[model samples]
Every structure is written in C-alpha cells, then in structure tokens.
Target: MDLEAFRSLPEWPMILRDSWETNAGWWQAGFTEGSDVEYEEQIKPIVRVGLGGAHRILDLGGGDGQLARVLAADGASTVVLDSSAAQLQTAHHRGSSVVLATGAALPFRDGSFDGVLICLVLEHVVELDEVLAEVARVLEPGGRFLLMLNHPILQTPGSGFIDDVDLGEQYWRLGPYLREDIQMEEVDAQIFVPFVHRPLSRYLNGASARGLMLVRMEEPPPPPGFVARAEEYLQVQEYPRLLVLHFERRP
Candidate 1:
C-alpha cells in the first residue's frame, strides 16, 4: 500500500514536526523503549565488526536523538540530522548536536559520514530514492546503513494495526506475517504519520542498487521484558517489529 494516494494534500515538514512535538515523549521513549536496546544487545555486535569508536556517524531522520546522544556519548563524532527546528531543538536539548536538514537533501560534503542510521524512518518519506542517493553520496567508501522499519506485511492499509496473529506453534504466535500487495490508505490518527507500505524486498534491492552491500538482515524478536511490560498480542514472535540491516558503500 502506497499511502500517498490517501493524502489529498501533502504535509511536507510541518505536520511531521507537529506529529512528534505533540507526542514528543513517544519519540524520546523509543530509545528507552525500542531498538536502541536491541541495537546494543543484538544489532551492535554485528554492526561493530567493521566499524569503530572513532567513526563519524550521521543519524538520518533522527527524531529527538535518543540513539544519537547515546552514540555521541559513546565517543563517536555523531551528527543527528532532521528537518524540524523543534525536533532539532529537542534533540539539542537532549544533548544532540543536530543540523537542521532533510534526508532528501543532506547538508554535508560527499563521503562525510562513516556510517548512517535511518532508524524507523524510511516508511514515512515520499522521496526515498533521493534520501538514499544522498546517503550514498555522503557515506565514506565502505560505509554502513542501518535501517529499522515496522513490518508492512502484518500491518497494512485500512485494516488497523494487527497486534499479533498466531502462528500456532509455540507459547507465542510468530505471525500476522501475511505478505500482501494491498492498496495504500492513510487513516486519520491523533498524529498524521504518512506511511507507505513496501515489500521488505524493495528496501534491500533499492539499497543494493545504490552502492550499499547488504551485510546483515535479521528480524528482532520481542524482548523477554515485552510481555512483563506491555500486553501486545502474540508477543509478535515473527512479525518483524524491527529489521537491522548493515550495508556498506561499494568501492
């Protein structure tokens, strides 16, 4: 489902900004709540094999800079970049040295960053090619791109977010992994988050063509704490709540 059709009008940056500021805490909670935890435990060990503490990193669409601040605090020369002033302000307030910029048009010289992380953001942008091309241009030779996305197969248009569908094998169901070529519908929410549904393949092929070599692809399972903390159906053992991809620029 490509949601751009449901939107009679486009909310370029303003709506995007408001969506986060209004739910500013949600954005902040991601670091404490989402992949940053997995990144440290599961994703980072795989990613750090080729990179180092001295590497300069660029975090794209880095809303509120939870991971960015962590990376910066970890001795990496980290730059968190986003288009919103308020988000940038929040990131700065949260201890991120953010530059006001959009992913489609990165504000940096070629091959500037050693690695780039586009966490949970590719689903929202209309101009993915532009942003990726920009990422390719800015990443140093052999640079890495780490992307995380909400699984589109299990969650689609019009039909509300399916919490967890049963795979019917273990204690937890590993599903809602129905791959469909469904239509795009942008439902109204408290926040207007424009999303486009793409088969997971689209991301890999796109990155492959853009000079990024696919190094890793893994679906992160829910943490054991997920059941104790919040109740979501099935524990989503297989729904692919997160995808960690490590790609390096082609020399």
Candidate 2:
C-alpha cells in the first residue's frame, strides 16, 4: 500500500518497522550497495573537498556504517548514528562507533561535530524539519553537512523509465512532481520500504529556517556503465540519479 493508504491503517508504523527489521540482515548482504563504487569515486571526493579539514564527523542514519567506514578510512574521526539496532550491530562489527538513535533527537551536545553526512536517508524520515534543526544544533559553527539523496525529480512517485521501442526514444516519465506524500517502494521482490517525498523547496527552506546556509548543490552525472546497460537504464543519462547538497551552520 502507498503512504496515503497506509496512513488510514493503524498498523503502518509496525509494518514499516517490521519490514526494515526483518530485512536488516538481508539488507546487509550488500545487494543494495551497488552504488558504493560511485560513492567512493564521485560522492566522497565532493564530501572531502567540502569538509576541507573537518575532523569529527557524524554519519547520521548511516546504515551498517558503510560511509562511516569510508570516512574513517580517510582518517576522519567518524561516528555512525542509526535508528536500527540490527543495522547498528553490523556497523559495530565493522569496527565503527555505532549509536542507536533517531535523527529527530540526536543525543549529542551542541557543536559536538564538525561535519555530518546524510546519504539516502531523509526520504525515509518523517520528521525532516526536526532533524534538520537537530543537525544545525549539533554541528559546530561554520561546520558543513553533506547530503546525498535520490533525486526528488527523478524519483518522485509514479515516475519511471520509459522505453519507446518503435520510436527508439527512452526517457523518464515524471509523476505528480509537487505533491508531498509517502510511497512504498519495492527494494527486493519481498521487501517494501517507505519513502517520504518532499519538494526541493522543503529541504532548502527548512535548512535555511534552522540557521543553515546552502553552500552548494550538485546533480552528478551518471557513470558510464550505468546508462550503457539495458534500455531501462538509458533514462539515467537524461537525468541525475542523486542530489548532493552542501550546507553550513551559520556562526
């Protein structure tokens, strides 16, 4: 069921949690981590360049400490914060300092971290504004926050890759672009995850209202092998797969 349909039912939260909790082990099998190559090559460089010399960093909602391991490998003092206990267990096993906590209520003190990395996370969070406020509160003055998410435009509800075989035209079809809603997406055949959709304005305006300044934004192009695959992958060449944003806490 979609978010709207599930909202009317009282069991949505339990269902959502069950889906993630049950799939936590399967999720760690790295089938979903195919983008790690892209992250290491494209995403991490942007983060390192943006952070400059930041030492203490928080990987908020960093499942299984994937990016935390990357940052730690790069010589940063990194901590992985996630709401999933099962996921945290995997992160802990990977030698990452894992904290079990929601983003809406970070347990750290003010100015506790010099930088924060949130990747493919906000779309699953219901309390996005509250989380942004908490990010601003915990980050040191002039600290930066790097965000990477599924592109709001390309990933909106009902949007999908379209292949016109006869015309030999392949592209993406956008759905209701402006609506904020919840969508249940199939990750694997049996797993359905909840994704909350919000407009780009919601992120920028929300961060701005919380004393965070938007420093830069990037929609990195697709890797060569991505669009070189099947016809369904061709749409990636016409649009970005992720939206990367850099925000700074004001002094």
Candidate 3:
C-alpha cells in the first residue's frame, strides 16, 4: 500500500470536471464512434462472453451510459455511475439509470454488485489505488470484474503512429514505458482530456493485492476496417490498442 511515489494529482478532480462540463456534447458524440468495428468486432465479443452469467452489474465511470444501456438491454440490472453531471444528463436522456459519483468513493454497500464493468476509465482517474480498492469493496464474492484499458505498452508516453516512407511501413514509436505521468490529449481546439500513464504492474498488482483474481486477459488488435479510416489505424492493427481483463472476486 506504499503509494508515496505514485501520488494522486491534486488538480485532477477540478480538471476532469471542467473538461467534461465544457465538452460533454463532444464526448457523447464520439462515445460509440467505433461501435460497428471496435465494439462489435473486438470489445463487445469479449464483454458478451464474460458477462454471460452475471445479473446485477455496475458500469463504473460509464459516461453518458452508452455501454450501460446496452448492458441493460441484455437483461442485466445495470446502473451507470459517473462523476460528470453533464455526462449523467446525457445518459439520462438515453433512458439509463445514472448516478453522479466518482469511482474512488462508491456509495454502495459491500457485495452490492454481482458484476462490474470499468471500460476505458482508469486512464483518466488520478486516484488509481482508491478506485481499484473501491471496485473490490463493492463486488460480491466471485463477482466478475470486466476491465478495458488503453494498452499500456502501446499508449505509453512518447508513443505515436508513424508512417515511415523510408522503412516502407506504418508503425508506432514507443519509449519511456515505465514513467508514470499525467498527459493532456487534445480533444478539440479549446479542450484537452487528461489521462494518467500507469504501468501494467501498477494495475495488476493493485487489483491482485485486493484479491481480484485475473481469469482472462486479451490484447486485441483493431478490426481490419479500422485501418481503412487512417494510416494511423494501420499502426494500431500492428500493435495492441486495448487490454481486456476479466477478474473474479475471490471467495
């Protein structure tokens, strides 16, 4: 539990609130942008298989409840918990039951949820240890925890898609993989989104310490048509972009 080195960002909460509040519309619009290819071909297949037997599910940081609505339609009693009020409003508009809450402090009783889905959210969270601990606290014994992250290796600091004409290939340049830092990725001319670059060991060890047993994991490539969109997508196909992990709360 010695997290003295990886301290949480003091300004992250305010930054997150401001970013989402100002760019809620833009976030919602791109929520399901790659639904046809990314979700259907890669992510949803794993989710569909992993969540097969679960009943009660919590979509932690389920912005705009796009994935929450899909989980509900599949017969799971689903609830979306997000920190952004504007995102919650968008989720409500989509008929999803939404709660405005951060993952670090979940207002739920122990063993309340039979399953949890945390997709692409941890990168933005500054309080990584707190959130993972809360995820363990809210899950029932043997409950499934399906997590999706931007692949740590592929999305590390100082990494980018490069179309090398001299090398006659498209590839990704990656380095400084172990350095943990806060990064601001540009979303629009006036907006930038914050993400924390954490190593794989941090995520795995943190959850393992809390008794979440990893049962399944995948580093899936982008679907073929993804390469058609841009030359950057070609590099994504070559390297892993998404890390899908399915863990079970130990009894």
Candidate 4:
C-alpha cells in the first residue's frame, strides 16, 4: 500500500495488530527458541547486558515472549506485553508473565519497570512519540530502555544488496533514507507486513525529548550464521543490519 493508503486508514493500529494475529503461528514456528541465529548470538547478548541487574523488566511488544523467557530464565521478573492476543497466548503457554496491551498506552503504573525492552517493534508502530512517552513513564529512575531496531538506513524500504556486474562488485544500496514513509514487507507469498521507515535521528531525538538519555548505541553487522545462510550477504558483511540503542530514564 502507498503512504496515502496507509494514512487514510484510521484503524491502522488495529489492522496491524490483526495482521500479526494472523501471522502469529507462522512467526512462532519460524523464530522458536534458537531458530534465529541473529537473536541467539547478537540481539539477546546485547539486550541482556543493556538491562544489567534490573529485576523488574517489561518486554514491550514481546511477541511469544522469546526474549522474555530468556530474561526470566536469568531470574528477572520479566513481563511480556503485546497487543496481539494470539501472540500473548503463546507467550503465556510458554510460561511467561504475559500482558495484552499496546505500547502507546501501557496499563501499568509509573515507574513500574526497572528495564524496558522494545526489540524490533518500533518500526511497526506509527505512534512513535506516544510509545516513547509511555516507555519513559513506565521506567523507574535510572532504568534502562533497550531500543532494538532493524538499522533504519540499511533496512529502509528499497534498500538492499546491489550486484553491479559492470564493477564486478556488490554494494549496499540505501533507499529514501531521509524520507519517512510506511511500506509493506512481504513475509510470505501474498502476506505483507507494514513498516514505518524513519531516519536515525528521529529515534534518538524522540527518546531524548521523553527524558530517555542515550547511554550507548550499537550498530552491529549480521551474525556469522545469518551471513552463512546466503552468499550475497557475505560480501556486505560489514554493513550493520541491526541498530541497538541503550537509553536510561533520566532521574
């Protein structure tokens, strides 16, 4: 769908949630524990360290509680909150403390969590400011907010590996990096997921305005196992596919 089409839909959020609900089974099966190499090797490690010793953790948009289960295994009281009931059901069945809610309006008290994690979720959310505000509100003083995303510049719509035959070299091509728009990504044949493409500054500045101070930022390349899956990725191995920002709630 085009930008105008997406904007015209007043129930976009609900529509998005419905899409996830429909794809919940597929997603669960595909990313089940240790199935995704990037999550197992890179994302999980970084998130764990970013959260530090926080006992009360909130996994925002935590679908099926994959990360939440890992954090809970480490003895943290990890609560998985997601908008899709189908996703939350799987999480609950997997022994996770699940909450059905949206990130824009968290059904929790102020300073409810010591650490908040929103992994690869913001891209799907149009209400970025509201979600960030809710994140800041729910995090206690000095709490960490781990914001993980598919690298905005690298993963932007139309961005991909360009195999230039004339040059006999492969390079990464970036799409309309500065232009923020919503695009649909096909997960399966005829199954499309919507993503909001925003510049890097948008996230950093938005969080900063919400009293979420940036502590550290990591732009890591694709994991070995991920690159090993395809020959094309081997050439652009240095390019980061993930952007992780560790932010602290300003006291």
Candidate 5:
C-alpha cells in the first residue's frame, strides 16, 4: 500500500493523550467551537446507547466525558476515564465524573459497571486485548457495550486507491488505512498511542473469548456534515462512521 505523506504537519499530540480524549477537551469548550463534525458524527450516537434508563455507564476512552455528561443528564450514572490529566480536568470542568486513567488497566472493580462505551478508543490503545479484558471484567452480567469506530474495511489502506473512484484530496490523501505492519513513536510531539486496523473478526472473537456476547452490531449512518464532507470527495455509499455495538457480559 502506498501511503501519502501524513498531514497535520509537525503533527503534535494535543493535550488529550488519545484521539477521542483530545476531542473531549474540545468538547469541554462547547465542542461546536472546533471539530463539531467529529462531535456530531462520532460522539452523539454513543450517548444514546442506553437512552432510556439510568444505567451505570463507563466511558472507557471518554476524555472530557461529553458523552458521559449526556448520559448522566439522561439520569444514567456515568464515569469517564482517560489517561490524560488535561482531558480529565476538562471532563470534570464539563460536569462529568471522570478519572485520569488508562483503558488497558482500568481502576474499577470487576462487575462494577452496568454498561461500558468504548467509542473511538481501542484504535489508539497499544494493548487492545488488555483493554478488552478490562472492559469485560468491569461489566456486570447482561451489561451492554457500545463501540464507535471508522470501519476498518472502508478505511483500510487500499480501499480508497481504486481508480474507478477519485477519493479527492482529503479521502485520497491521508494515512493508508490498512497495513498490517506499521511502527512509529513520538511521545511529546505526537501521541505515542499506536493504532491498529484489525478486521471485524478480531473484535468479535476477542469479545467472545472474554465471555461477552454480541447483542447488536450496527453501522450508524453518517451525520449531515459527514455526508457532505464525503460528497466533496466521492459518493460514500457504504462507509460507517460509528459502529454501534451492544454486548452482554457473562451471566
């Protein structure tokens, strides 16, 4: 796969350690201030994960807890956890109950939470299996898990390179989405957090191994801004912005 040069030149990691964590900091500032597209397409739907009741929801990579706050407002008991102090500060400032922590080694006890939401989170974790194990351990029997992600199939390295379609500047011009082997490290300048694009089977099998059952897996349709942005490049017939999943813990 031929990858174009990485953009966001001088690529610096924002105070938020991971992708969503930085986004949470932005969300703390009314979100609409910047990156509203991500906020709309990525964050909002997860907030509706357990819309009706007040289940205890743990926002796994939930930076400033924007989604946690929304869930809390809906009367759900919510806790946002992230590794960055800056992001946690933003989360608290935004009125969310948040913890400064890493997803791989969560601080909560086993079976402590009723539900867990890993929105745009695992992509950044260096230890995906550890994080999934922690998530499974924290959830109670029959609890739910909702995950949001840019689909690996469409985002795979070669998916955008087909000649029949011109992915335009933005789509055609970014990291090659699918490449099994990639390595880089930049701590202070860029987030040291690594990203992986394993197929859906990787996620499903891991969850099953940990005694979690898939209740639902949905490709949430993109929001208006998302649709428009994609249109600028190509007609996006089937790229999922969010993977709304529901999983139940071992009974």
Candidate 6:
C-alpha cells in the first residue's frame, strides 16, 4: 500500500502491528543471534555499557530476545517485552523471559526495574510520549534507560549518500529533518514496515519532561562490517548511523 493509502486508515497502529506479525518469521531469520552487523557490533556494546550493574532489567520491544539474552548472560534478570506474539515465542523458546505487551502500557508496577532498554523500536511506535512516560514509571529511582535509534537526521525518508560526478565529491544528503511524520518503509517485496520520524529535540524533551534526565549520549559511526557492505559507504564512514541515549530516573 502507498503512503497516502496507509495514512487514510483509521487503525494504522493495528495495521502496523499486523504487518510485524506477518513479517516476524523474516525478521527472526535476518536479525536473530549475531546476524545483523549493526546490532552485534555497535548497538549491543553501547547498551551493555549504559545499563551495566543494573540487576533487574526490562528490554522493551526486544524482538527475539537478542539484547535480553546478552543481559541475561551478564547475570542480569532480563525480561523481553513485545507486542508481537510470534516474536515473543521465538524469544521464549530461546530461554528468555518473554512478555507480550505494548510499550505505552507496560504490564508491571511502578519502579519495577532498575534498567530499561529499547533499541531500534521507538521508530515504529506512534505514542512516543506515552511510551516514554511508561518507561519512566517502570524505572526505579536512579535507574538507567538505554535508548537506541537509527539517527533521526540521517535516516529520514529522503536522506542518503550523494555522489557528485561534476564536483568529484561524495557527501550525505539529509531529508526534511524537522518534519515529523510516519511513512511506510518497504523492507521486502510486498512487505511494508511503518516508521515514525521525530527530531532529536522531541526525544530529549519528552524524556526530560517525564523525569528522565539524560546522563550520556553516543553517536556511533558505521561499524566496519556495515562500511564493508558497500563501497560508497566508505566515503561517509565518519558519519554516524546510530544514536544511543542513556537517561536516568530522577529520585
């Protein structure tokens, strides 16, 4: 379906969830274990460092329990939560404590977890403020919330690498960074995934308003594996593709 057609649907969120349900198998095959280079090399290490020393952790929207497994291996009690039952089933079979739930309404008590991590999931969620509030509510005082995102400015719909033959130079071109909108990303033939784009200020301000203070932020360049996948990417190797934010719950 085209973007205009999708925008006309009243239950876009449900449609998005159904799309994920249908693509769960494909995602499990592609991203499970160490298959995705970006996840294994850059995202995982940053999350490990940001949420270190936290015993009770919640991996919100942690599909297939990849990150949760890593935390569990480090001896932290980790719970993997996702709205897709098919994804949670794979995680459960892989020995992760799985919960079928949405981020906006977590199935837990206030201050239930010492650490919460959401990686590459927020872009799909429509209720950003509600999710952030729930994240703050479930995190205990001084708890850390590790958030990972495809860099907003770089991943915008129209953003991409540009090769200028006339100028004999190659650079990255950014999309409408300030425009906040949801669009359908065609991941495979006949399969589409919805992605919501919001500026950096929205995330920072939303978290801060919900009593979550930013402790640290990291913008990591493309990993070696990512750069090696394409020759043109080498030209923009210094540009970061991932944005990791570490926030703490205020006491």
lDDT of 2 by residue, 4-33 (tens): 555678876566666667778877774325
What TM-score quantifies how close candidate 4 is to the native fold? 0.94
Model 3: per-residue Cα lDDT over 1-251, one tens digit each: 11233355465468767877777778766546444467657766677677766899999998878777677778898999999999898888888888898899999999999999998889877788899899999999999999999999877766776779998887778867787876677757766887678799899999999989899888877777666777567556657788998999999
Q: Which sequence of candidate numbers ranks them by TM-score, best first? A: 4, 6, 3, 2, 1, 5
**What TM-score do all the candidates reach, one by one?**
0.76, 0.89, 0.90, 0.94, 0.75, 0.93
Residue runs of model 5 more than 4 Å from their true location after superposition: 1-35, 41-43, 158-194
Evaluated against the true structure, the overall lDDT of model 4 is 0.88
lDDT of each: 0.66, 0.81, 0.81, 0.88, 0.65, 0.88
**Candidate 6 residue-wise lDDT, 80-133, digit = tens:** 999999999999999999999899999999999999999999988878899999
* Model 6 stretches with alpha carbons more than 4 Å out: 1-9, 162-170
Positional deviation of residue 116's Cα in model 3 after best superposition, in angstroms: 0.4
Worst 10 residues of 6 by lDDT: 1-10
Better of 1 and 6 by TM-score: 6
TM-score-wise, the better of 1 and 3 is: 3
Off by over 4 Å in 2: 1-13, 31-36, 165-168
Give the least accurate 10-residue stretch of model 5, judged by summed lDDT: 1-10
Model 5 RMSD to the real structure?
A: 6.3
* Predicted candidate 1, C-alpha RMSD: 4.8
lDDT of 4 by residue, 1-251 (tens): 44446768898877788888988888888776778888898988887788868899999999999998788878899999999999999999999998998999999999999999999899988889999999999999999999999989887778776889999988888888887788778867877777889899999999999999999988888889899998888876888889999999999
Lowest lDDT block of 10, candidate 2: 30-39
Better of 4 and 6 by TM-score: 4
